[model samples]
Target: MVDQQTPVGANAPTRSGGAPALRERLTRRKPVEKLVAETQGAEGAGLRRHMGFWQLAMIGIGATLGTGIFVVLGEAVPVAGPAVVLAFVLAGVTALFSALAYAEMAGMIPASGSAYSYSYATMGEFMAWVCGWCLMLTYGVSVAAVGVGWGQYINELLHLTTGLSMPAAMLAGPLEGGLINVPAAIVVLLSMFALLVGVRESSRVNAVMVAIKIAILVMFVAIAVTAVQDGNFAPFMPMGMAGVSAAGATLFFSYIGFDSASTASEEAKNPQRDLPRAIMFSMILVTALYCLVAFTAVGALNWADFADGETSLAGILTAVTGTTVWAVIFAAGAVLALASVVLVVLYSQTRILYAMSRDGLIPKAFSTLDAKGTPRANTIITSVLIALLAALIPLGPLADATAIGTLFAFALVNVAVLVLRRSRPDLKRAFRMPGAPVTPVLGVLSCAYLMFSMALSVWVAFLAWLAVGLVIYFSYSMRRSALEHEDTVEVRS
Candidate 1:
């Protein structure tokens, strides 16, 4: 039989000679200095660094704007009543802290994995594994939820435009009294094909889609503001502080996609400079849009009038305009916009898995690039998994689970920024968080608090998923990790 060892680098040490003990292997961290050097070396880093600040910012906006304003507002408004506007502001503050931390890390690492790469370089391998596992779950589930939102908008648009609509049995998952969500599955497949083609193509398409959605939102706000009733402002705090806080926790999901820009660090032309700008610019821009939409929508009608998951925004437009025309246009815009959300979320998932595979945490096949420099295997695997989930699962509970998983990752990123600053003060950073330890501390605390706001079942689901990740890490990844092999060789040599 051909020796499997022959294909490995001749210098790589084997277990027979001696490898890192299991405990050490799991705890060892990647040096920040080494990570920077490897990135600079340009050794077989297959992705093309073609994105500019504008492209990166557009990607962030595309990823962030769609899911929250278009779908989430319906659920959030009912919880916080008219005070949901304040909830958007609250959520934006939490997002800003995490975004600032991400900016510093992206400027320092400028690689594909986002928080996972940052944690690996600053913290230990085990922390990195946990962060990567959380992100994998968050992005995967978020994409599925976005797909369902797109499906809902498509149905609304069709009923308005052609007097035709999908059957209820075919419009949702079995958990929602339907067999499957066909439109959700369709959007996932469409986005998958776009990714397989290339990042440049997908990103360009996403930018155009983002512009259209923004215009649609601007139009909605303008019309809704005109119809605002003064009495809608009087009892705005009907649900009080507890409701607003809970709503803020839910709205935080809208900001989840801001890190999607950081995940493209390898693909940015000037990652050290452009990534920080993209991260900050996208968060500020999306936050402004969310607050405007929330303020206008609630003012136009009482908060109690907003229905959960019933095409809330479009219904408001139709009711106010005394016609379905504006609603049709709004629904069409949502379909276009949410498709971009799915694309960006799926893109982030494939890249994160690719980074992990390159480290030998999963399998190298996932990191193998096609001629276009894309990890086609990883993309295909992610596409299939997300598509199945979007088709078979209900959206509401899935969204809550996504929130907790993402919060866990955000907290880790905040910690990574703090740890790296202390460990390697000499490393050059293109951007720094304003308050250093203070900002990062708040980032950690806010994320922890929001995570606690989730339902007990959501916490249960997140813990169960983490349990699975630990089993895989110990059984398969601990044996194959490339870092352990490299360390073993250096010690033996």
Candidate 2:
């Protein structure tokens, strides 16, 4: 067995007892600060940073408007009734606070791995590893879950419009007592290929899907508002404030995908200048759009009849139009929108893993970039794991688990903003969060409140995941940490 211990001052040549294991103490900055510098300087090895505030907004809409709205209606509407509209506003406000905090961090750190990199720079190694690990749960597997959802809606659309007779087992997810969901698996593979091709290419396709999605929602609202019945909202707070808060927890998931935009800081045209703008702008746009859709949706249908699963929006349109045409079109738009989200989110997860591997925190294999500068090895492995999980489990658990991992990251980032402000006040910030203490405090409290409202089972699952992370960190990460050296240190003073 190899001994991992280092003598005191192991990295300092000036130390008495041991020759400097000079590389160890210096480990602190390279994986943390150096990577930070690398992203700002040289990370655009493949794709050019050409996105603007508008493109960033579209990316936000593309990611957030998909899965939760399409799938969550069945879950949230029943719980809060017409008050689900208020729930959307409540969740939007909570997420907006966190997003503002994130924008501030992105301006300062401007790294490729979003919250993980920020944690490393401010909180040090242990928390960074945990954040990165939880991030995998948040993003890596979410793509698989959304892909399965897209498959269901697509199959239904085909049946409703094309009159194709598809078998239940072929179309149904594995969790639904089916052997395999061929369409879901197929979509995952297709998305993997697109991601492998390149981000620029993916973004082009993403842009088109985003436009369609926005159009579909606008069309839904325009028609729905015309059909509003005041009767539907007589008992607006049917389930009361508690129900709104509870549903707000899940609806918060719809607001989260904006963070992925910040992860592209490495590929941003001007990170310190534009990354913060992009992130905040995206958050604001999505929040307004969600509020609009929620208000219109509750007014278009009786709150009691919204538990129609994937058909909630469609059903409302059908009831109002006295035809299925608009509903089917809306569902089809949803499928395309969700598909883009799954692909982009999966790409974000793999890239984050690749970043960690490059720091030697994980196996070096994970960081290997193909000729195209895509992290093929990491992407494939993560996809396979996500596919298996999605095949066997339902979306509720997967979504809640993702929320837990994400909120944990959010709390760390909120705290990190404070750490960096105090520790590196001299660092130039292109963007700033006003009322520093209040912003971060509210951010943490809001995230924590939502996290608690989730099912107890989610809490247990999160604990189990944390246990696994600790085991890995103690067993291998501590020993291999680039910062393990006892001697060398970088100091500003």
Against the reference, the lDDT scores of all candidates come to: 0.85, 0.74
TM-score of 2: 0.90
Worst 10 residues of 2 by lDDT: 1-10
Q: What does candidate 1's lDDT look like per residue over 39-158, in tens digits?
A: 555645577778999999988888888877898889998888889999888888988999999999999998788899898876668888999999988999999999998988888888
lDDT, candidate 2, 114-224, per-residue tens: 888887776656778889999988886577667767777777678669878568787656667777767667777777888778877887898899888888888988999
Considering only N, C-alpha and C atoms within 3 Å, which residue pairs clash in candidate 2?
10-21
lDDT of 2: 0.74
Candidate 1 segments whose C-alpha is farther than 4 A from its true place? 1-17, 40-45, 307-311, 488-493
Indicate which candidate wins on TM-score: 1
How close to the true structure is residue 264 of candidate 1, measured as C-alpha lDDT? Answer: 90
> What TM-score do all the candidates reach, one by one?
0.94, 0.90
Runs off by more than 4 Å, candidate 2: 1-33, 40-55, 163-165, 171-174, 308-310, 485-493
